[model samples]
Target: MSSSEVECGPSFPELIRRKRDGGQLSKQEIGAFMRGITSGSIQEGQIGAMLMAIWQKGMVAEETVALTQEMMHSGEVLQWPKAWDGLVVDKHSTGGVGDKISLSLAPALAACGVKVPMISGRGLAHTGGTLDKLESIPGFTVTQPVEKIRQILEDVGCCIVGQTETLVPADRVMYALRDATSTVDSLPLITGSILSKKGAEGLNALVLDVKFGKAALYKDLDSARGLAQSMVTVGNGMGIRTGAVLSRMDAPIGRMVGNTLEVCEALECLKGQGPDDLEELVKSLGGYLLWMSGRTASLEQGQEALAKVLHNGAALQKFEAMLQAQGVSADIARSLCSSQCDYFLHLKPAEHKTELTAQSDGTVVDIDGMVLAQVLHALGAGRTKAGEPINHSVGAELLVILGQKVKKGEPWLRIHYDSPAPNAKQHSDLQAALLVGKADSYLASPRVAEFILPPKM
Candidate 1:
């Protein structure tokens, strides 16, 4: 069928056929599909078939833009007229293993005088989610209403909340269906889902950290670049200035991965004492957002401004203040530890410690991010369903990083787990996943791979 013939609320077979045959969908057809899926008028199987077809046939730039706009309009938009003096800026990472840049960057930017209303997601598959990690703190709720979210951003200049059901409800339904149907990786669908929520934020500018490696959703450079380009195209079409950084993911961003552990690492970064690779990424992303917001003329100047906040302890102070305002206390702060996750409930804190003694260690060559995340998942460190609670206290600690020297029979990395959950399978998975090599081995890994810029057109 031609675009004009495809009516709103069309038959499942007709809609499926149009997309499956590489025909364009009218805006009304796309809008109706979103509303139908979200309003329960559409069955899961039909939605799955249509999504599969869209994934196979692909969406053009115009279709992608229309899809994003419809999704954005299905929900409420947030803004702060009086509080934010300059352009309100936000950052998103295409989920990555051990990526906790938001925990630092949000407060760091806010401290630098920009409003950051960050709506984050939870872990799905192998990558960590920002909302899941932030919730590790006691009483640190992510379910605040839109009014409170506005107040929080006004009072503290930043607030991280769970993506409200009312905001981009369409994307929520589509994503759930995509997840079940194995169509979650479609570039246009991914782009629409991401930009819709981000666009609904009423943001002046946005930055994305498009990651590529074994652990990220986009597992290679080509896929990551394609995803980045689609997002930029859609964001620009909607009048939101957008850019992306194609960062390395050969190894995890920081030393930790589980909720609380990663939070502590982010805290360290805000205090100007974080891993080198993680720090570089923070400065790079923070700098880009600053430039987009017109706070800095160049990346170097933005980096220096970010450094002042980190080194002067302003960022850490803002973070603590925000946490306190959000209801987390200092006494219970240690629960942020990767081993203390069991404190929340029937979940037990990780008590078992297994030292991975080096068999013939010269240097640590690689740490597989996906394998590491799977080990945590198997060990009950994270939840499979959105409703499942995480054991935030249980996680791994690396004693030897990549390019670090190690002695034979010495500890390379320590595996910490809450012993209550059965972990026989996870232990084997973790063992096979972490690989170490001889110091004499020649290939040296750079901290960053390449930079992905915004689309010029």
Candidate 2:
């Protein structure tokens, strides 16, 4: 057997039994559990049972630590050059609607002299995926061999790609089992799944954007905070400097939602002309990451440094370079990044377009993000099951921002879709997403509500 494959250990039922009844597991026991799956000694049914057990009876700090470490070690742990230490960094998001922060943040960080080997995944259920967004660019490649990935990092300073086959193999088997078992939201399992892949990347520091709101995985602050704390502790325990940003996901992040539309918005963000909320998130997340890696004196200073790159054209240049490094043609990359170029000319746009208008006059209060995600998912922008193909051109664009006053018959949202367009009910749902409230109670909420840092070791 290869050294990366985990070795089989003690009784599987014994570990399941101990965890089922709320008993703590030793590091050796958890290691065995992770290895058994990686070694093919564990069955899927038992894996499901243990997932439920972890869901029902939560893990203690030590057990969580063991599970994260074991999962990370179940496959090949990536190696970097000696000089890259403390300069390699990454950011992960517990996803939400229209969350395309990574698209702008990774390349921007690279421009700041950080090495970003970003491993991303596809969209499942309602939340959009970074890989899916990047795929909208005709020739952008999301997978690269280790040698090429290293070269890209050395040249471009950043590369967003998928987890290699040998990287975090244990999480591959068990992570798939999570959704089917209804234990998808379990805290320990989430930490293990997220941090394991990141740990395999040999990162020196990590930042998490753990979202919470109507459209977020955790619907409230307390639930999201618990998951964030669990991830922070587990991540730090695994020897990676880690922290989290608690951001609200009540509405779609930018002026757009879906694969291609988000890519366009992200490009605009790269040019320092995107929506206020989207730009804020990129700066806030990237700023915290820079501070976590000790590149800046404070979080605010880190933000200013990042913002400087965005407006000065350095970050956008890195993004154009990243596109070509990842397989996009040089001409296409340059044109798309150019200020005078139109994005839709080079990228695919939907076959049909429909606009929705405001029916009454009032200040806009809420635009339901969950509603938009579901509608867009139905329109072929998302996948119900893994490996299902999505329509990159299918998406929606907001014509008005939150708190804007609109008169009757004013166009509020424009949807792009293919033939067999949205039915009456779907159209109604889209209209329902926009909510207007009296102007008296207009209070603009912060996109980033709180920043949670790791405790000093």
Candidate 3:
């Protein structure tokens, strides 16, 4: 059947009913629904119903591929010059707290000779967003026209920006509907939403950082693995080389957990001196992309190359170049890279503060990332809804981390705030989030649990 005929063939209600009853949808049926969505022929109610149905019944691999492809084609699919071949690659992480890998990884990959056009989003719920962190820099902008994005990529080999309204219209509508309908967790829906955007970017290769545990989108390992596998399957099925790594998010990836602070932490990582877990995660994800794009012979080799750029200051230079390309002053970027402490000193300090000291001498067994993120959100570090303002400077800092032994009077967390101090309940909650136990009971968790590659063709 012709594409037009497919759109005219099925009634929207019938399609929803079929999927609701566990019936597999044909490519034409899925394509028709997507077109209806893009054209406004499908009402929001209908979309919500279909999403709920799919959430309940789930979708098969083929159905997911169809949805992703249709969404990718619903708007412009970016195309680079033929001469550039396929040096383009990008990474997407299932949101997590203190997950600022993109800030460093983009420039790191670009320094390794791959072009990175990273389209990021804002913080939703407890997970922090890349665009939010970038905007925390003085005079840095996240919104840009497509021509400008192209220009920045050509000049800097990378640009991290938000999704343009016209880039993938279908996913934009579907994402809002998913957010409203509580269907964000469906494996197929996530696979479609993520790959649709990445596919639309016209990437040569893609890396998926699927995180699980208390602070991540998926709370369990099995579910996170399923989502990762589904995304890889659909992405490769659509011809974009994809790989995934399952990482633990039981604790925040780095020491800082707020906007400006996370950006500062990323700057430290670029200079070869951030938290070990954050640096290692960036290397693992960047190395996979390098290997997938054939920049390195193997993952180990790719990591070695990344390490070279990091230690030799090439990655930091690339990052500064990207910042300047985005309109930050060269002096400011250089100062941020060279002396972050001095750079931070100029920013206004929060008006109120409180410190939480260790109750007894012991080892830090766990710092619940989800609870900490919630506390940060309550303190105005993150947005509870879209378009809300983030405090940027107001957040809690972890003075002690996992497996560290602390004395009774040692401070483990310091809360920075601008207004009234945290009330009694907030104080109790913050204290409960930190777990201290016997020194020998501390068992550190591995950061990278498993590395998954696209299935053999």
Candidate 4:
């Protein structure tokens, strides 16, 4: 049939069958199909079917690359001048609850002389997006024109823009279809969508934070490692120096979870006093990025340099500078926090009163990440659908971490919510997600995960 006769260029059923049967598609065919979907020429149902097929059969590296290029071409690619060059380093994280490390890491890296053009997103599942947390700061604008992004990067050494419709528009369409069809769990599709946006931005080096746990989307070490490897491979293939770091999500990253509250916690990290896990993750990722960018010779050197930036208070200054460059009013920073309370600057009161304590008082063993996230979501810290406003005051502030001793009457964690609706929903869910066992129930960490480097082409 002629191109004109085929409405979306290729029949949806035919393309779905081709991929489902492990057949390869030429770049043009895949591009045409994605273009049709994003342009509304193809029905959402057809697009959904294609997503499911791709998820099940998987895409070859070539197909994944083609898909990435097509999605990137579906939107505008950002441009920057050579004079603004200082190795631009940025980071991406797989979705997980309490994954707010980027909020502090970006500024800390920028303070160390790297230009960070950080594009962030909002909450998708249980984990919150960097843009959403930054939005909690009054009047901070995540939306900026491409030129404005470059300008802010040039002047302040950093900028965090929201995922825009004008950039990677095809991925935008595909992501929604995948979410609707339950095909989002596929590793190939996930890697393509994640890397396409980061690659399209044209950075010198990139760092990926791949998290796995009940609270994380990957859910286990093996799955998370595969994703990390794929992202690094694809990224390096596209000529971007990419490194992946696996992080623990057995519990929340810090003491806070809501937007404003997480922002406060992030501020604490920039000031060099945050949770041990959160700080370690941020420093490790930042160190790798710095090394990839050639700002430092090795991870040890990069960590040493990052430490000086933190110790001298330059990291906090860079963070405030980037916030101002992005149009956050000066008072927004001051009003949200200082050196005092890390939970909330104003100590916003919550109406709910509940705690999940260890009943038997053994070593804290397993905390279901997904269950904890769901409880918080039901309590209104996250959205049930797209465009839903997040309740910045509602989330969990964890007190007891893994392997910590907990007495029977001691509070394990505090649930914060403003009203009756979420209180009734969160209390029971929170209690059930935590499984406390005897001394031998302690979780073990992986001695080593896969290394992510460019293949021997």
Winner by TM-score? 2
Please list the residue runs of candidate 2 whose C-alpha ends up more than 4 Å from where it truly belongs after superposition. 1-10
Q: Which stretches of candidate 1 lie over 4 Å from their true place?
A: 1-15, 38-45, 82-86, 330-349, 420-428, 440-442, 455-457
Give per-residue CA lDDT, model 4, range 1-457, as digits (tens). Answer: 3222244455667877788888888788888787776677777777887888888888887788788777877888766778645487789987777778888888889888888888888886577878877777667899998888887878788888887778888888888778889997887788889888987787888888887776776778888888888788778766778888877676677777777677777787887877777777777888888888878888878878777776677888888888788876777665444455444444454567566676667777866667777877777778868799877777777777777767787788777777645454556677776667777778655412444544441
Candidate 1 structure lDDT: 0.78
Looking at model 2, how many pairs of residues clash? 0
Alpha-carbon lDDT of model 2: 0.91
Ranked by lDDT, top first? 2, 3, 1, 4
Q: What is the lDDT of candidate 3?
A: 0.87
Better of 3 and 4 by TM-score: 3
Q: Rate the local accuracy (lDDT) of all candidates.
A: 0.78, 0.91, 0.87, 0.76
Candidate 4 matches the true fold with a TM-score of 0.89
Candidate 4's C-alpha runs over 4 A off are: 1-17, 38-46, 84-86, 334-337, 341-353, 421-425, 435-451, 455-457
> Tens-digit lDDT track for model 1 on 95-188?
7778899999998998888888898888876777788777776678888888888888878888888888689888877888898999987988
TM-scores, each model vs. reference? 0.89, 0.97, 0.96, 0.89
**lDDT by residue (tens digit), candidate 2, 1-457:** 3222324444778778878999999898788777778878778898999999999999998998899999999988889999998999999998988888999999999999999999999998999999999999989999899999999999999999988998989998888899889998888999999999999999999999999999999999999999999999998999999999999999899989999999999999999898999989999999988998989989999999889998999999999999999999999999999997799988999999999999789999889999999998998999988899999999999998889998889999999999669999998998899998788757899899998898862
lDDT of 4: 0.76
Output the better candidate (3/4) by lDDT: 3
Model with the higher lDDT, candidate 2 or 3: 2
Question: In candidate 3, which residue ranges exceed 4 Å CA deviation?
Answer: 1-6, 339-341, 345-348
